[model samples]
Target: MWAVASLLPARRMLASAPRGDGRPVMLLPGLVNSDRSLFLMRRYLRRLGYDAVGWGLGRNLGARAIGGEGERLLARVARLHEESGQTVTLVGVSLGGIMARFVAHRLPEAVREVITISSPYAGDPRATRVWRMFERLTGERIDAEGVVARRVEIARPLPVPATAIWSRSDGLVNGLICRDPEEDGCRAIEVRSGHLGVQIRPAVLRTVADILAVPGQGPLGTFRP
Candidate 1:
């Protein structure tokens, strides 16, 4: 429904959105999804004058999809940083956002900032409606010791600028856990959107562009629009 609703207004939204400074923005897809899911978003970003691309690693099946300990993901970011001669901005949806945070933690120097769309990185994995599916696809128990520890680690304050776009209307995950309230560096933006819809919603796209346009040294505060 969100994808369909986004169609009519997408063109108008893209036309009025804030332009980018040609910084490379990498879009990461959600669990059980591939770069294909974010085609519209990439197109919109490109239209907004940003060089946006997908996380070329096919599907996002957790560590398995990106290689052990995200070595492959790190390499991808490093390559983009080297090629662009600028820190890359990561925009991730759902599980992809979690992975983006992990990558940012691993390669802070190469990452400009991270933007997560409805990514539940702040709380229990079971709080999400798709935990069971996540386990089946990744073959990792959410309750396992390693998984729990990793969650704690990722939930901590990120070293660089961070933004979380989440919705209370999200049906797939607990919205409260999507952003870290204690992280002063992380800007939490609230929107009225379903879990999947938030990715393509026009308002969300505009918010992303606005955040991206802010200078690196500028302050990031909560956005309620």
Candidate 2:
């Protein structure tokens, strides 16, 4: 059985709604997703009084050009950091989360914290689905020795305070991988929601608000039993 404390209603945890001074936060969407994917979360964060923005880059099925895309993301993060004079928190879902980790590693000066939703930082070699054909078509290889190894390295003892939210019901990445190998600055929380719906789920929204409210609490700040 899943370790879900409750399945009927996904729990919503909010440390306290943020006060709107338009603090900057970047929301990176999952694989096969676009900036619009974070629409709901953006709206919720705005309501809670935060200036949450999307990662503007187009379709994010996977890291097409690690070099180019990574640079683009890093530059954008740097801009946000300069504009806000605040350490912009990185919130990514799925592949976006993986990308966020890379950006954070390269530009720690620009990142505050990293929160991932159902993201498999430790390379899910089981991605044997039809979607991967796009990876081949686009020449993006997640299985490359260097790529997989880097992901594994960053996945454990994560370069930053990492918070992972996952569900056994996830039809995508294995939730087990969401658990941090070391517990010091990492946390793994269980949520009840489908893989795709996680972005819009109310419980996830509340959890996000709670987590963001804390300056440096890392993941699972929206703790619940």
Candidate 3:
């Protein structure tokens, strides 16, 4: 039922969502998900005048996306920034949002802003429904010192503007923890949505479009929600 309901709203936003200034955007998918999961969002953003592209890293593999010496994920962001010759905005879902923050922190000059949907970067992994599964798939124990340190790093504010969109009804990650810790460089939007639908719901899509449409202020000092 949720899946069927999402289509109408998503379609509605596709037609009515505000257009942006053709800025380059990189859409990052959640953990264990692939670029295929973001195809619809990318298509919609493209139609709305933004140059949206995928991370092209296939299925997300947690830390590897942003860790190790030659990180393939960072390479992808760099390539996009170079190709577009403009600062890239990152729109990340779930774990992808955590990666986006890391990217913005590492390459602040190349990143313009970040928008996260249903991400638990500031939350405890144990509070998530799929925390165990994530640990299993990524082969990184949540209790490890290194893992905890990295999570702490991801929770910090980025040099650029940031926006976090979450819902109280989220079933996967505890919704309360899926918020921005600091409002100085970030703003939080509360929506009545499930974890899965937050990224595709019409209202959320419209909000994202509007956020991206803001001029020089980006969502930081401009967006109210």
Q: TM-scores for all candidates? A: 0.94, 0.82, 0.90
Largest TM-score belongs to which candidate?
1
lDDT by residue for model 3 over 1-225, one digit each (tens)? Answer: 675476784675458766678899999899888888888778878999999998887788786654553277778888889988999999999988878888888888889999888889887888899889898878889888888887887788778988888877788998777776565778787777788746666666777887798722544322222
List the candidates ranked by TM-score, beginning with the highest. 1, 3, 2
* Local accuracy of candidate 2 as per-residue lDDT tens digits, 86-203: 9888888877777887888888887888888877665464642333654664466767777666666666565566677777677766766655655567677778776766777666
Q: Model 2: how large is the Cα RMSD against the reference?
A: 4.6
Clashes of 2: 1
Residue 87, model 2: lDDT of: 81
Model 2: ten consecutive residues of lowest lDDT: 1-10
The TM-score obtained by model 2 is: 0.82
RMSD of each: 1.7, 4.6, 2.6
Error of 3 at 2 (Å): 2.5
Which portions of model 1 show Cα errors greater than 4 Å? 215-224
lDDT of 1 at 77: 92
